[model samples]
Target: MAFPPQVRGNKVDPDLLAQLVPGTSSRADVIALIGSPTAKATFDDNTWLYIGEVTRPVIAATNTVLDQQVVVLTFDGSGVLRTVERKNQDDSVPVAVVSRATPAPGNDASFLQQLIGNVGKFSPTQTDTSRSRQGGATNPGNF
Candidate 1:
């Protein structure tokens, strides 16, 4: 059985967001209202980001992007909220994905090569059993 793709991150609430006033809401206020951010800006220390995405995979098909959302919160040096920006899937830019497969670091063997690879690797031999039996001594009791 196939399972559905999962959704991650907190769901944004418009009513709660409306209460977050810029220049008045502090970092503690945002954390209390919206919870922890999904990510922070790499280049800036004042940006908080929230991301949500839903993916669904179909039979004989690549994983499809059902939904995507991004919420960006900018803050001033004083830890006060400065701006709130929201983006959706429609705002995304399509990128070309290369599907080239990497070759492994080993000899590539064909079916016939693999089948005949161990042809001379092993040899069957029979052990002699006609020898005299020994009773825990160098000389055997019966020869």
Candidate 2:
């Protein structure tokens, strides 16, 4: 039996994911449950995000993004499943991170003060270069 293109396309096994619901699944189990994630966020490894994008361009110049889904699952401090959210088709909003530079609100330790504090804490008399030398014959005269 021939199925429609949408039906024939890749799909998530509703039954398998359904079976594992409310249970703490390990890394391997999560992989089995849902294939490799599309993107791994920065500064946060405990969270896994899986995304799928479908785009279809028709016979004309007009193109269409058929569907896109982003499933985000968060693991807690102990690496246990904390929450799972399925953001399926057309459920996402594009946002851009703004990079702006603004001065501190009040007068605090300036950049140079912070640098001086760190340097002052160091022993100026300590010969650090003396520790750099390593290689030498234990008893060169023995040869």
lDDT of 1 by residue, 10-80 (tens): 65777888889998999999999989998899999799988888888777876677888898999999999
Clashes of each: 0, 0
Model 2: per-residue lDDT, tens digit, 7-49?
2233455565565444476656777776766666788988887
Candidate 2 lDDT at 38 equals 64
Show pairs that collide, candidate 1.
Answer: none
Q: Can you give the lDDT of residue 57 in candidate 2?
A: 49
User: Model 2: what TM-score?
Assistant: 0.49
Best by lDDT: 1
* 112: Cα error in model 2, Å: 50
**C-alpha positional error of residue 121 in candidate 2 after TM-score superposition, expressed in Å:** 54
